[model samples]
Target: MHILVVDDESVIREGLARILEGDSFTVDAAKNGHAAIELLQQKQFDLIITDLKMPGMSGFEVLNAVKILQPDTPVIMITGFATVETAVEAMKNGTVDYIVKPFTPEQILEKVHLALEQKKSTVEDIVVKKEIDCHHGFDEFVGESREMQKVYRRIIQVAATDSTVLITGESGTGKEVAARAIHKHSSRRDQPFVAVDCTALAENLLESELFGHVKGSFTGAMQTKMGLLMVADGGTLFLDEVSNISLSTQAKLLRVLQERQVTPIGGTQPVSFNIHLVAATNRSLKAMVAEGKFREDLFFRLNIIPLELPPLRERKGDIPLLIRHFMNKFVEEVGKDVRGISPDAMHFLENYSYPGNVRELVNTIERAVVLCEGDVIQKENLELGEAAEVCSTGFDGFVPTNAEALKEMKRHIRDRSVENVEKAFVIQALKRNNWNISRAAEETGMLRPNFQTMLKRLGISVKDYFGR
Candidate 1:
């Protein structure tokens, strides 16, 4: 870690710098707080060790300035008159730690280590919290896609309202996850988020599961049981694959949505419940209604505000993010010290269609992380099974050097014949993918609309390339 040492005393500064250097830390020294601030402006440091009694700018002033400038970096204060009140005031002024003067080198280093550790922990916490806030509850929802942005905005807008929501998307598009997010972000976040796969259980069990049942209601009913709806009262009920629910069950559910009550099996009294209903289906509900497989009125009841999660192919830009997220999760689960994925591995990940959507991508990364032995995950570590050759993106097994990076940047800037940067990026992606638009789009993590724009800008004709 980079450490900045600030003190007016040359002897103290030189002594501390020697100790820190011995500990293998990169050190920057300044005789006063003003010099320290100037050095900080030019470069980033992980921790700042400043003497509280500096002449030009006092340690308190420096701490306040750093708090405003780079709050993530921590500052530790050194004081000769180490009073409880002074230490507390220094802490309140944003000093991560306060050390007494005449401290051993070990004591100072220990405090610096603690400060850096806290800073790292704080950064990780912020990242996870931001993800949870963005996704509501599930971290599976990954996107910077314009369509996904609209979906996120809609979710936030409708979360506070107790409207019945219908989530529609392809099978692997994370509809159930979206349902949970709505519930988590809603007023009833503390209550249960009950999910029932409408197609998994038999009709009789499904009805009993949702509406509850009294003792001796059915052949196997030995005890009174609360159904999913009542359990989810004050929260949300997610009905997955809602189109598959039997017509009879649909009618019963529609009544619950309409009247906010559930009648236990073979019971006369209808128990009142307050719940937000969220239903999801891969099939087109409108088509199902026309085909008499789904109830039109029930569809109307659930379709008050719809949220459709885009397919993986539509938001391929999130693959890198999803890969990193899954890698971190797997590292925690498996207790591994793997550093990162190889460039070729990332290329392969970016190109695949991921027909199973984000779930498929996550599973793929998790599997790679678990099977890999080395510090970095490589292309050979992944067992894609049938997905191996589906990538359109190129893999050159290149690890970038500073000279290569500079050359690539200069080449990129000069390539006006290839179109603007976005288009050129797509063309470079196509070159990587062997000129396959579909694969190039996947590799570049561009959705079809954005990919199409990329190709048009690059003077590429899909018809000419694919003979479509």
Candidate 2:
């Protein structure tokens, strides 16, 4: 550890440096606060020992400078004139401890060790708290794969700005979770976070819900209601499954995005709003725009910052981490004694494809925790259903007249079966990802070029799957 000694007297400064250096600490001596401040700006110190009364700048000034520059470093005040009030003042100014002048070597050493230990404890506490916050604050997104790391980086990058974000992913792939994470990390974190499910309400009701309504705007509009846009003023408004919004509502949403103003159904004046918009969708807004089903202008406005979340299948390496997270969560919630999953059960879970993504994994673990009778969760505790079944049906009742014919027939059957399975696998991945070739390739854990090569070999046209 490195320490800085600031004392106007040469003998005192040199003595403190020698004592600390003898104890295996690198020491730097400064005649006054200005020199100490200069040294602080140039290098980092683990601790600062400054005399309370100095020539030009006092120890209080040094303490204040240390607080501004390196608040984590502990400061110890030493002085010839020591009193209860001075000690109290030093403590209040953020000094770790104070020592009187003409002190013994043992006294100085004991105070330095105690201050360093306290600083270590404080730092460790902060680190542990940050780790806990990262898990719970980010909604328990337990993954460290390259794909997840990319998503994390993107979320952080966009969260610093007010740019509109469009999150695209399959259902249950945590689009809303990503939106919440963005909001949590943004400047408006302390403000409200209003989430609206666009698929939940009808066109008129959704409009009223978003744009608010004056009293008597419609048959059931008995009272004036504040819209989510107004509710999320100075905060964030998350629109979940924005692709389900009607074309007319889409036009109004575009206006809101463009003008930052909202007009109620029966009100005349427009209510201005300052809100961060984050929209999520499982469907393709680009395709919808091409088909005229969605407004192209609105799509462009919402697509300023696009974040595509990779499916769970694409980052299978993170499955074990996610499983452990879910297991801990469900075990606590269900009040079960389930401590772990059997090796066989864990292997099955890791290999089984999760079509519904993380949400499905969460459900599976919850169910297993509830059904597990012993301390460990076995394969029988999991209810994967049809997803767990492996195809093993063999040709039956087929007899050939000769050995050569039988051999040829078997070869043809094997080749046909392999081709069918491969085609089905590719098609399923494509279907799951809305026919996006890149996404399909990622979901199947294949490189884009390799996936495209397979598509060509299989004679599969991506355009054919569009709008399906």
Candidate 3:
């Protein structure tokens, strides 16, 4: 946690810093509200302690600035003459707590914890209200099934808290989308949402990309760089395929999460970070932990708020809704005349078990929409990549009551079957040209920055790619 102490009195300013530092918080002292505002612009702090009556800028001014500058940040007010009206005024001005000048050490610490806890609650209330306020799911994600309703309810319940979320599901199950929705509905919605694919990058560069490094930390070190932890300060960091992170990097990450401080490589000082973590993985982290591949401690730390996504096969009732959603999307996207799926094609789709889940189904719909001659997508237009077994009951698998699953399944064959195919494609392009990034970017018709961003998201470091 990072805290800013602002007071015209030197004793009060420095004393608070010392007190917070002892509590394991990174503290910065500002002589007045003006200096506090300046520091606020340069860095992110979890809490701000400002005296109500400052020489240059009053605490009221600082409170207003904080509300504008970092609205989510909590501010505590301090004054010598504490009165009920003054306290109400301070609270009205957005001070989480009001304290008198002669406050004891216990009072300060108690108020600090209480205020921070309230801040967490405030964030949850704001986010949860925003999500449930609509009383509906996002337009992009369509599911009216009971299972999906449960998922939606879970998102609503958990989106409000700063708890580290561990989203587990198979590939193509929209894990990242769920993460994004959680962020969108949270207090940090306006902040940057950085997504990193753990499987895309090599082991060595992952830390530097995440925790950052100082210049000359290693050979070919060019300039000092800010890590994603700093960049994501006061916001959420989504780690995709987190199971792929190496054990060594996992140890470093565990320290950061535990301490809330990140020391750049070759740098002596540890930078304070206030970031929410939301990690997703297709692989079983528990199994990996049992096998001694994943760190048990790190696994336990990340499993604070577990959210498991149900596969499409298990949510067969939602197939029709999903198909229609995609149908409308692709209809406008491809500018095709295709209106909807034929009865036979819909039956074929409903019967098939989508191994790859929603992603494969969408890919199939996109292809079918393009190939369809008329308004309706015919069964053959589906190209029914694979056939599903039929039960005598009909569309259902085997049970007559649940027999809706038994119809002849039309397999959804998508070209990008591999989850990391895009990452691999970029890697292949880089390798084909001997890792000449600029050349690869030009050949691939992507800007250099875009290519580099893709690499960063995939965690692909050119230096690491060449066995650096």
Candidate 4:
């Protein structure tokens, strides 16, 4: 584990570093609190030892900063002029322990060991509780529908073994949550669970991130760095939006999977890792492979065990359960006194189809909870968006007697479906091009004027997606 030592005195800082280093701990020492805070921002430390009295930015100030930055990390305060009042004040300010200066190395080591052990126990307890909750029919999921039950079963079946899992679903269908569930139930639950978003980084940066690079490997490579695969060694690595990975990276990933080893960008030495791989994507790898966008070999490797999540529309019976779950969650989080949803609000929520799936429902509920004034949430409190407003009009009791009327009804349904699909396509194109209309049009093989016309017809505002 990594530990940081902060002291204005060089002698105290060096002495603490020697003691911690001798105990097999990676240590970084800072002469003052300002330098210590800078290191904290750059790297993560499991424990921090700071002297109470400093020239500026005292240990108490450092503790406050850490509470805002890394709240979970334990801090130990050391002072030469230690008193009962000072010790009590340190404990009140969130320091795990207080140590008097001129202390023996044994005392410091014992305190460090105790603090780390306590932190480990607290983390493991939380993990164990979550695992237990999930074991009882997947607590993360709210539905009791057969579709979700099947998903739970598949997760349990594949989690026991170290098999590559590919989760396919639409956006906001809780793909990452499923990946976490798999990792939590697996034997490597105690190890690190690293998650990476493939779509967030450029191709070159992503390649460097996945495979470590030695010093002077590339233009910006100033020092050797360990890749995420090595960081997740003996644990799980979740790759979200894996389909966005470029073909060249796919080939390299396939080799890593086939050989169970990774070679750094400039280093010839190969480092081996044992990680349970879980990949998720909203897009279809099969179609991408057929279109020559994704490698078929890598697809097969990742698809050893496949799990598909059902969209909210497909399992509408679970909407009420989900609404209540989200309502209780947001009410507590927002510290609102909302006790229930009105009948009209619940009806609108249950009937409205969430194109964005569970994530949309979550946002809707949180908004209502914040806007709600009374004990119960009203229909006005729920903002279902423009799409929901358009789709809310359904022919509930309309019985068409003539063939013409029935044909008109069918035509209306078809038009609405087409409109939804067209809007989704246009939005996706704009997103891929970072809201650049000209580039989006060119990529989609459409004239700029035609793309703008379509955007206007679909009521899509470029400004809405620009900065956001």
| lDDT winner | 4
Query: lDDT by residue for model 4 over 1-468, one digit each (tens)?
Result: 999999999999999999999999999999998999899899999999998889989999999989978999999999776464786688887999988868999999999999999999989998996566443337477776667878988988988999999999998889999999999889999999999999999998888888888999999999999999999999999999999999999999899989999998999999999999999999989989989999999999999999999987666556766777888999889999888776557656655557688998899999999999999888889876565776554332346777987998677567656765776688789879988999999999999999999976654556434542
lDDT for each of the candidates?
A: 0.78, 0.84, 0.80, 0.85
For candidate 3, report its TM-score. Answer: 0.57
RMSD (Cα, Å) of candidate 1? 16.1
Residue-level lDDT for 1 in candidate 4: 98
| Tens digits of per-residue lDDT for model 1, 1-468 | 888999999998998899899999999999987798788788898998888887879888889878877778898888886464676698986888888878898897799888888988999998997676565323346665566777777787778799889899987788887887788789888998999998899999999999999999989999999988899888888999998999998888888778888899988999999888888998889978988988999989989998888877556555655676778889999999887887566655665556577777778888888889998898888887544463322212234456866676456335522333454476567668777768877876778788887654433443322321
Root-mean-square deviation per candidate: 16.1, 13.4, 21.4, 21.6
The residue pairs in collision within model 4 are none
Candidate 1: the clashing residue pairs are 392-433, 394-432
lDDT of candidate 3 over 401-440, digit per residue (tens):
2233233232212311231366557877887888899999
**Higher lDDT: candidate 1 or 4?**
4
Sequence-dependent TM-score of model 4: 0.57
Where does candidate 2 stray beyond 4 Å? 1-138, 390-468
Positional deviation of 120 in candidate 4, in angstroms? 32
Model 2 clash count equals 0
TM-score of 1: 0.57
Best by TM-score: 2
